[model samples]
Target: MDRQEDRHRLDLRLALADLVADTAACVRFFSRLPVPKLCSADDPARLPDFSQISRAIPLAGIVVAMPAGLLVLLLGLSQLPTLASGFLVVGMLAMVTGALHEDGLADVADGFFGGHTPERRLEIMKDSRIGAFGSIALIVSLGLKAVLIAALLDRYTPLEAMVILLGAESLGRTLIVWQWSTLPAARPDGLAHRFGVPISKTFKQACIFGAACLLPTLPVLPLPSLALGLILAPLAAHGVGMLAKARIGGFSGDVLGAVQQVGTLVFLAGCLAVA
Candidate 1:
C-alpha cells in the first residue's frame, strides 16, 4: 500500500507538470513565443489532461495557421505584380482559419432562416448535415473574404500584408476569449464546458493574449484605430451575444467560433476604413 501510494503521488506530480508544459507550448506557439522542448509523441506514458491547452488554443491556431494567408499573398504578389499583397493576405488568412467561423455562420443562417421556432433552430444547428441557407451563407461569406483580401493585397506591400495577417488572427483569437468569458453555454455539457475556464482566468488570458494583437497595430494604425478596436471588441461581442440569444437561445461552441471570425473581419474592416 505504501509503495502504491508513493507511485500515485509521483504520477500526480508528473501530470501537473505536463499540463503546465502544454499550456506553455500553446502560448509559445501563439505569440511566436519560444520555449524549450517538453513532450514527444514517442513517450510511452500517458501525460496530463488536454484541458489546460484549450486556454491557448486560439493563440496556437493563429501561430500554426496564419502563414497560409501569407503564402497565398506571396503567390498573388508573384502572379500579379501590379496589385499589393494585403488583400490576398487577409483573404488567405480567412481561409487559413479554415472557414471555421464561416461554418458557424452557415449553421446559424440555416437554423435562423429556415427553422420556425427556437427549438427547431437549435435542432437544425445540431444536425451535422448542411442546408440550402447554410450553403448560401458559406458561399457569400467566402466570396466576400476572397474579394476583400484580393483588394487589400492589390493595395499593400508584402510587409504590410504580413502585419495584417498576424494582426487579424491575433485580434480574432482575442475576440474569441471574450465570448468564452462572457457568453453562457448554449448546450449543457457541450464543447464550451470542456474549453471553458473561469471568467477570472479568461480575463487574464485575454489581457496576455491581447498583446499579440495590440503590439502589431501600434505601427500600422493611429490611436483612433486602437481606441476603436478596444471599443469595438466588446460591442461586437455584445451583438453576437444578442444574435446567440435570439437564435440558439445562448452561445454554443459554433456561435463562439462565429463570433471570433466575424469579429476579426469586422475589426480589420473598421481599422482599414479608418486608415
Candidate 2:
C-alpha cells in the first residue's frame, strides 16, 4: 500500500507538471507575452507541439486577455464612455496579441477576394503588403467588434463585462483549435502545416477543456445569452470553414486567424443580444 501511494503521488505530480508546461507553450504561441520556460525540458528555440499543447489553448486565451479584461474593468469603474472604453480594450488586445488574428483576417480577405486563381490567392495571402480588400476588412471587423463590446459594457456591470470578455477570448481560441483539428492545411509549406493537424483525441480533450473555461461565466451571465453565444460562435466558425473550403480547398494559418476573429465577434454579439 505504501509503494502504491507513492507511485500515485508521482503520477499526479507529473500530470501537474505537464499541464503547466502545456499552458505555457500555448501562451507563448498565441501571444507575445514573455513567459519564462516552465519546464526544464522545453527548448526555447523550438515551436510548441500543437497536438499536445492545443488542449491548453483556451486557458492560454484567458491569460492572454487578462490584461485587457483588467483594463476594461478599470475603465468601467472610472465611468469612461462605453464606446471609448470598448475601443481602448480592443486596441489593448491587438497590442497584446500583436494583432496576430487581425493580420490573418486581412490576409484572408485580400487573398479570397482579390485573386481569381488559387495560386494567385495563395500568393496574395503570402504578401506582406495590405491591399484594398485587406484594409477594408480590418476596418469593418475592428469597428464592429468595438461596437459590440461597447454595447456589452453599457448593459452589464464591470465584473460581468470582464467575465464576458474572458469567455469570448477563450471561446474564440476554442474555435481556432476546432478548425485546426477539422481542416487540413491549405498549403504544403506554411506554419499551419508545420504545426500539423491534431489527432482526434487531442481535439476532443481540447473541446472539453475549452468548455470548462466558460463555466466561470455561468454565474455572471444569463443562461439564454450564454447558450446563444455558445451556439452562434461555433456556427460562425463553421461558416468560415465552409468559405475557406470553397475558396482554397482547406484552411491556412490566416484562415484559422480569421475564424478566431469571426468567432469572437459572433459570441459577443450573441451574448449582448440577449443580455
Q: Candidates' lDDT values, in order? A: 0.62, 0.88
RMSD (Å) per prediction: 7.2, 1.3
Extract clashing residue pairs from model 1.
84-153, 84-154, 85-153, 86-152, 86-153, 87-149, 87-152, 87-153, 88-149
Clashes of each: 9, 0
List runs of model 2 lying over 4 Å from the truth: none
Cα lDDT tens digits for candidate 1, 181-260: 66677777766555444365645665575675557657765677556756776578678878888776778767766776
Best by lDDT: 2
Model 2 Cα shift for residue 76 (angstroms) = 0.8
TM-score of 1: 0.73
By TM-score, the best candidate is: 2
Q: State every prediction's TM-score relative to the real structure.
A: 0.73, 0.96
